[model samples]
Target: MKNLFHSYFESFKGLRKEIWLLSLITLINRAGTMVIPFLSLYLTKNRGFSLEEVGWILTFFGLGSVTGSWLGGKLTDKIGHYRTMVISLLLSSVFFILLQFPSSFWAICLGIYLVMTVADIFRPAVFVAISAYSKPENRTRSITLIRLAINLGFSAGPAIGGLIIATAGYSGLFWVDGITCFLAGILLLKLLHPKRAKTEMEDTFIQAKSAMSDKPYLLFILAMVLFGFIFIQYFSTMPLYYSEYHKLNEMQIGLLLGLNGLLIFLFEMPLIKFLESRRHTATGYLILGTFLTGISFLAINLSDWAGILVVGMLLVTIGEMIGFPFSNSFALNRSDGKKRGSYMALYSISFSISHIFGHNSGMQLINRFGYEFTWYLMLGFALLACLLLFILKKILLRENV
Candidate 1:
């Protein structure tokens, strides 16, 4: 196992400077994201509110993130990723500090939405930077490793957030996230100093825009949006399942979340590479992953054991191990380097939109329809994505590939 680990990491032996910087940035960014998974719970359970009210607050987060993602893309197109990232970090930090004040439910919701929007600017811009810096040969592994870092950070963040929420209250999360945002900006600036493009080909903003509008890319984006629609359920609904249905406490729930992160952290690098090596079926991996997530959610109904819930989550993690990075890589790889930030921003909009719907409407789905039905709904979304991607690939082959 140790030998395999060494050999696996050897794949990244000499990546472009930008890939490493982006990995670090991804790590820092996710560390701050400790809030998202827990925010709904904190509001509903800790603050003496109901899930429906929490849903409304979470909806704002989704909407704000969507708006921010769209606008950030435009900003990246106009200014540059580095500047966009800087502005995003600065704005997110200001909002994080603002969170320290006690406010009404509506006010808190507004703050959540605001920070979610402003803070999220880094990802697309960083994607732009990574695409700008890497060559096609190393791109898949490069993106995969970036994901590796993201999960590694996320691995720690949720577990830590659970601890902090228990000991320090929601306010503590704000302070930590705020400080991380400011430092993340500084780390990004220091690590990924923007380049003036040694050649015209170095930056591809206009080319990216043109390419993004292409049939294959647009269809792929649609698939991703649906994929996001299903995936965000993990954040919004899965917790409610563990809490209300499983009868688990925060500490136990935190362990499951932590275990989810650990699997991604420990196994994702090898698992993604292993999948990639068997065939060049990025689309297929996505379908399989999404299918498994739906199946796994259904499987949760089979057992009430918290340990079994971990088993189900492991399945979900494996599914993500196959799918999410595959979709991200495909979208970013197809994008032109200079305009990668904008392209990813738009891609991110699909994700943000789903989160909005997932948190707000998803709670309603659970409330009105029940948890099992929502999982079934997520399954349908995944199956739809599979069919769409298969058809889209066929079209791409005939038309573009």
Candidate 2:
């Protein structure tokens, strides 16, 4: 045990104090969020809204998040990540807490749309801080550590949130989520601060040259955007799909999502290590993940194979575990010194874009076609993503190397 602890601390020798603080911030914030994975259920069951109406609401949230992410990237560059994160957290909390009082559909939609903007802004800034605070060599591990905290907290949050919603109303969960935000923001405020790299004092030429010549990195971002569309099933249409096809109860859906989070937490680290060891093959993992996620929807559509859905999610877990860190590290590795955050921010945009379009569009497909057909369409999307990943990987390789 002592040897293991020593090795762990040794591995973290250069990790800054602030990054660790941000990890705590992530845990607290995610623990509080308890809302996202189950948002579809709450809106449908509590609000007496149709799945299509939920789609419209999600579209707005996605749109707001896109705008917020853009603003966050700009603000992080202009003002500071710390300041931007704090304000966004406070604002989103206010909007979330307001859900307690309740309002008409239009009013709630407007409020949620607005609040999600700030909530979206909070993510990029925190990540920018993550990139900034860590040494380049350890950037991947640090980001993985942050992801671990997020998934760890996230893993527990859904099951708890399910219980809360079962016992209390949706409003209670909103209140709890809001309070968690405030707590996370407070921790970041207390523990984190800006620290410049010593290399910043030297010539900036090194970073610029690295970024300008990085073909693989640019291609990686494009692929990430495509995969984001497929992976977004967790939020978009998957919940409704599970509910409708599998006839899953709220508790069951909650357990499935909790299991999803748990898989991420359990395998993400070792997966990252393995993927990085064969970095050249990251595209394969990307392809593999998308195929699994896309095809799983079919399994969900066909038999009442909730078990298959779980298995598919485990594939997703494997894919995400392999691809996400590899992609982030690849991006950070190739980022131009001053534009690292910008690169990350742009990569971040695709995820929200997928959420905005993927769910609503998938719903439309489902409404028009049968359930199985709609999934085939999603499967087509995933195949398209794989093709893009392959093309980009080829370019990234021959372009620079």
For model 2, how does the per-residue alpha-carbon lDDT over 1-401 read when each residue is reduced to its tens digit? Answer: 79755654554456678778888888888888888777778888877788778777777778888888777766665556677788887877787787656556777677767777788787667776776788776677788888888877877788789888889878789998998898887776677743442233132334334322456555565566667876776755777777887789888887887777777755566555555556555456666666666666555556665588887677666767766776666665555465554555666776778777766676677788867787677677767777777787677667668
Which parts of model 1 are misplaced by more than 4 Å? 33-52, 158-173, 196-202, 205-212, 243-252, 298-311, 337-339
lDDT of 1 by residue, 1-401 (tens): 79987966865665787788778877887877787778767676667778778767767787888878877777766677778888898678778878657458888887877777787766676666566677765666677788888877877788788888789988898888888888888887777666632232335534555435567777878888887777777765788888998888988887787777777777777676667678766667777877877677677776666677877788888888778778777777666543665568878887877766655667779999998788777777778888888887687577654
Q: Which ten residues in a row have the lowest lDDT in candidate 2?
A: 197-206
Candidate 1: residue 130 Cα off by (Å): 1.7
| Candidate 2: count of backbone clashes, pairs at least 3 residues apart or interchain | 0
Q: Candidate 1 — what's its lDDT?
A: 0.74
lDDT of 1 at 102: 45
**How high is each candidate's TM-score?**
0.85, 0.80
For candidate 1, the per-residue lDDT at 204 reads 52
